[model samples]
Target: METYDKIGINYNKTRKVDQRIASIIEENLQPKGINLKLLDVGAGTGNYSNFFSSKGYNVTALEPSEIMLAQASHNNNIKWIKGSAEDIDIQDNFFDGVFSVLASHHFNNLQLAISEINRTLKSKHFAVIFNADPSLVSKKSWLFDYFEIVFEKAISKYINIESFKSLIQSTANTHVKIIDYPLPDNLTDNFFASGWKKPSLYLDQTFISGISPLASLETNTLNLIQERLENDLKNGTWNNKYGQILEENHFDDGYRFLIWQKP
Candidate 1:
């Protein structure tokens, strides 16, 4: 809880579920024509859990941080549980499906976590939504130039795409499919990458801190980067250089949808 508690306060206040992202997640869940019991690994505040529940699937939203889990909405269809990805407390082979979105990086032990995900899932149908490979971060990110240190440190924590595939494959004998997910024009999640099109959102102190990587930066460094970004936006330097990002509806910022199933 040390890791998540540091940044879980007021999480739901800034992080709202984006329908566009939700639609993609729903698609990846691959409903099997009936009510399914799904487990949301590292579920922050039951956003996705509630989404699945609304669609008639029984959802269990697991989060280790009490502060974050407390923010979740109370729904009869969705059960909120206190747990961690590395060691899930649920019974073995219980869930019809398991899904983890933007939460893998938080796992203390990646292999153990995947093993638990595999153990809990009743079958091979599972999805893990991970942020894009570190190498692809700079390709379309505006923060790379302004907050290199923050982004670099953040990238170090992410499990490489290939490495993730190997881990999942070893844990479960299933065919893994990786798909790129681009930032939508009106992305509502407010994560670090969600602000690519709306640069000003990055300058907001509260908004930036809500993102783990950016929040991990020293206060002095964070302030300096914010100042620089603010000045650039006001002086038109941001638009003059990265103006093209505004023209595009979506940018590929290293988000990938990993779906696995038995062949």
Candidate 2:
């Protein structure tokens, strides 16, 4: 069974597409035009795939998890395929553009996946939106203070931005551009760090369950973290330390858009 298959039951309830991020993706691929033949590698639940399809792009939504794919909204413009990133079952130079959002960390082999993306992209343009190395972003995160172990583990899982840029450039001979994406206060998507400003949302079991790192924690660990967080919020301890962040409208928590294009 795929990893998301086990944890994706309530995914759609919280992982809706934030149009602000969607528009950025659209703008990145818009140069290719609406007739672009696009592939969404790791199209978990097809939120972005459906978004692009609705805008008139012919999108192939490839995902390894049946549970995630099953939850995708039915759309005539999207051709859904059950597949993995490292071994895409598509013809060579087939797609005009390819994109993946918040899904690369779960890949079994990052190098092979990049090779496959290069192999199948006719335009040799690949755009991926993912978290940078957690070490760079977690220093200011409340998660680092509360869920120390889980946050540390996540730091090891995420790729360093510089290393990832070098990898993409070396592997595919593509020019890579990094775009910083700050988490908006009103972000609709409830990913791991989306609740940066609204810390209380982390106390919700359903919300945390939708995040892989937090969801994977043992019951006791989660209970302890929740208890500590609740105490901090009630006593104004959390606000004393991190309350200044609440005044900001958005935060740059190492979320970035990496666009790779072959010259």
Q: Tens digits of per-residue lDDT for model 2 on 71-157?
A: 888778899999899999999888878888888888889889988988998764555545455766756567578777876887788
Clash number for every model?
1, 0
Model 2 gets an lDDT of 0.82
| Residues 133-207 of candidate 1: C-alpha lDDT, one tens digit per residue | 665776445768886886677667787887888778887767788888877877667887788778888778778
Shift of residue 95 alpha carbon in model 1, Å:
1.1
Off by over 4 Å in 1: 139-141
Per-model TM-score versus the true fold:
0.93, 0.95
What lDDT score is found at residue 242 in candidate 1? 90
